[model samples]
Target: GLIGKQPSAEMERKYSNETQVTPQTPPAFIFTCQDDRAVHPDNSIRYYQALMRNGVPSQLHIYPKGGHGYGKRFTFPYTEQLQYLLTDFLNEQLSK
Candidate 1:
């Protein structure tokens, strides 16, 4: 929406997660849905790739369905699976 309304460098830096990814940045566990239309899944994918290149330990999940707002609300069909992923990732990170 903001991109379509008025594009700017500041907006891009703030809104684009990939822009903030760096080698020294903390690791992340990212998830996205295949059917998310509001924001293309590339955002997450790009960020994951950046993390990998930066040698950060990261996990990514692309659900078969769900959408942009599927997080926390747990309203999607595969929300249970996503929860499992999040739990596993957190456990592993915490143990390390």
Candidate 2:
């Protein structure tokens, strides 16, 4: 039988809470948007800082303005910025 799965409220809440807890340390790139309203950008900022403090190779970009769901549908100065960030991260990771 094909089973349809939907996230239970408990699961959803757990995931949401987990997002708030920054990783102890991250060894790779971390990307975050400053103007993101849905998820406070501070979480990413703190995580990136933690990575930096631990001597991990990481970078973060905080756009002046780019609301949530900016995905590829919107065009703003940050769009180009995010593109370059992604490209750079890929190159760095693949080179290793």
Candidate 3:
């Protein structure tokens, strides 16, 4: 599986995008599922935290359910709510 395939030294460069974030980074919107097994929800948390720490405007939504790969389509109880919230965030951010 992809998780078992740890990057060799040469491929270590292909990794998380966290380090690329900076104070000048643009605003961000992040979300994740608490019950997602394929991906740890904290990835979103960490990035959101980083964005806040770096002074970038951001919004994060961690649903109590909804697993990985929720994407743009409808899924789970809170999917539509999250989408609406995301839309609101986008509108607010883009307006400023």
Question: Which has the greatest lDDT?
Answer: 1
lDDT per residue as tens, model 2, 1-96: 011257777665555423434444434555556777677777667666666666667777766676766776666656776778888887986787
Q: List the residue pairs that clash in candidate 1.
A: none
What lDDT is obtained when candidate 1 is compared to the true structure?
0.83
How far off is model 2, as Cα RMSD? Answer: 7.1
Question: Ten consecutive residues with minimal summed lDDT in candidate 2?
Answer: 17-26
Once fitted onto the true fold, the runs of candidate 3 whose alpha carbons sit more than 4 angstroms away are: 1-14
lDDT of 3 at 55: 90
lDDT of the candidates, in the order given = 0.83, 0.63, 0.77
For all predicted structures, in order, the TM-scores are 0.83, 0.59, 0.79
Between candidates 1 and 3, which one is better according to TM-score? Answer: 1
- The better candidate by lDDT, 2 or 3, is 3
Candidates sorted on lDDT, descending: 1, 3, 2
Candidate 1, residues 1-96, lDDT tens digits: the string is 647767687888888878787888887988888888887788889999989988899998888788778766756887777778888988998999
Output the lDDT of residue 80, model 2.
74
Error of 1 at 42 (Å): 0.7
